[model samples]
Target: MTAAAPAPRTPRRRGRPSRTQTETGPATRDRILEAAREEFSERGYEKTSVRGIAKTAGVDSALVHHYFGTKEQVFEAAIEVAFAPALDAPAALEEGPLDGVGERLTRFILGIWENPATRTPLLAIVRSAVNNETAAAVFRRLVAAQLLRRIAGALDVPDGELRAELAAAQLVGIAMLRYVIKVEPLASADPEQIVRRVAPVVQAHLTGH
Candidate 1:
């Protein structure tokens, strides 16, 4: 029989196309983070492992380590994602009059928890803080570095660091007790009412009111 003609062979590109299965790194990272938040919130820090986070994200456990070195790192990143608005508010405040900084900050914090979008993560953080000292350190570092420090820097005053820490402690403590711990009255109280009552207290800490 006559030899059949060979099928055409297409030349390959100089380099291999990306081996990555994910189309977008940032989007995948965000999904991983969101999944981590949900898992951490639902399971609590001690029970939520890197493998669990990865499974929730539908990615390999190694990817979690690739993106975020450790469980602590993942938790920190998740916290930052959860609190981005509040963390960024101080910089936003700088663009406007500083007179209403306290009110704005109070509203921002309450708004985060009142909204289901942020409430889940915030609850996770509170649960972690109450259950684990290491988790609390992670929470404190994120808040102090991202929110408190910047706010303190915005206002020139003595003991700004202390004021910032105190303000954060009050807000976080209230959130933990009322929301996470389900403290009576505070837990049932309307968020707006709480804001009105607590904002002034936080304002005093921030601005010496």
Candidate 2:
């Protein structure tokens, strides 16, 4: 009497997945950022909403909130993603002779615009900032704090902040014309040619020469 051979074991039902089990951290965050970039670029910050970004990302609105606390936070994260490469411009300055810093900075900034991959999101952020004051404030803060100040600090010269800002103005003007406004020959001209011509002016700004 085999003790009625223990009753057949029942299979356990799967419960709702935990956040860790369901969420794919980096990939989901990246998707949200990409969606935010597109939404903000197209609609501007005031009009872009968390629900809209979540819809674009194909994730729940809750997921977007979970990843980035607010719309402003999402926009900031998107800006960082779009500008991460350009943010390293200071490092380029660090690597080479001071004389070549302008060229390095120009080449790096323009390279971002030249590549469609980086340029599109950049265009979006720029357009949003231009159209919306709140967005502009955020963009200004990031540019000033992250890129401009770092570059100025690295220069270690009197009025370095002014010089860095001047150089940024030159580059941003060029970007607006070439990419956003799509102004004539400048828009279509060879990137190297643009660099050669513009780098010297940037050098003057940086070196006061």
lDDT of 1 by residue, 1-209 (tens): 99999999776444222336335588879989989998988998899999899899988777777788789999989877876767766775566555666667777777777788778777778788779988989987887787778888987678988887887788878777776778898988888888888877887887787
TM-scores, one per candidate: 0.79, 0.85
Best-matching candidate per TM-score: 2
| Model 1 bad stretches (over 4 Å) | 1-24, 92-99
By summed lDDT, the worst window of 10 consecutive residues in model 2 runs over: 12-21
In order, candidate lDDTs are: 0.79, 0.88
For residues 1-209, write the lDDT of model 2, one tens digit per residue.
55667878666334332465345778888888889988987887889999999899988787787778878889988888888878888988898888888898999899888888988888888988888887788899999999999999999889999999999999999999999999999989999999999999999999887
**At residue 86, what lDDT does model 2 achieve?**
84
Scored by lDDT, model 2 comes in at 0.88
Steric clash count of candidate 2 = 0
RMSDs, each prediction? Answer: 5.5, 6.0
